[model samples]
Target: MKSNIIRSVLSATALGVLSSSAMAHGDEEHAKPRTFDASKVEATAFGQEGNPKKVSRVIHVGMSDHMRFSPATISVKRGETVKLVVRNDGQILHEMVLGTKEALKEHAELMKKFPEMEHADSNMAHVKPGKAGEIIWQFTKAGEFEFACLQPGHFEAGMVGKVLVK
Candidate 1:
């Protein structure tokens, strides 16, 4: 009788596990995959209407003929929205490329492959002299990133800034 009771309990435990696994499988069958609509996404300039100004820390990056960025070091909280307004005060085209240091290094190499490669994401922008551009980014991770100009040896010329997100 004692052995029979033990066997019954073991059978019940096995059945419970099997039932849960079956239920999980059923849930997967009923689950719907998430989809995104590209048309629903729109790009808005920073400080624009209809888009609430994110609690952003603004950084005014100025480029000059000597290939340099003013205020080369900036600090911000991790995950805080940042509004980087890049102004080219020089006579030539300049850009503000923001990314991880490694990413920027890789991008510099990729730029060699495609001379026209420009920052086209929501997190980066390119600007020309006498013109201004803005990039709204929220650094989700705490790390050191560099904002530089990949305009043909501009970075080597010292057109770079240190972005500390922490």
Candidate 2:
């Protein structure tokens, strides 16, 4: 009888979480799966997803357990298509999400509120420890952008970077 009650509570909690959209947690499979729709991709304030075939250059980024990203600041040319190869060298999960500082901060707050929120978007790459992920994007607009790991306390711990597009 006790086991049955526990199961019921757990199921309810899971359902509640699933009902809302949450940030990705750097897992192979998200609780709420979201597939990338290349056909529907559009330009945004940051940029739009790039064509892998049109990649102008590739940049490698490393994420570590120390709450840091190697070569935090990146430079790119406006309208250039770049392939970001992100690797996780740490033992824990880490993600790289590109956006404006304000957007990142708001998303980070949401992540803190829902630690298990599952999210997947073209602008973000959720990498597992010792594994690699990639994000191909075109810097359509010329401005300064930011990237950070919004995993629970990761962002608050200063895991952030800059992207300058000229």
* Residue 66 lDDT in candidate 2: 94
Candidate 2 regions with alpha-carbon error over 4 angstroms:
1-17, 20-38
Kindly provide the TM-score of model 2 when superposed on the true structure, using C-alpha atoms: 0.81
lDDT of 1 by residue, 55-136 (tens): 4577788888798888788887875776777888998777777766755665565455444432344545566568777766
Tens digit per residue, CA lDDT, model 2, 62-165: 99999999989999999999999999999998999998887788778767666777666788888888988888889999999999999999999999999999
Top candidate on lDDT is 2
TM-score, per-candidate, Cα-based: 0.65, 0.81
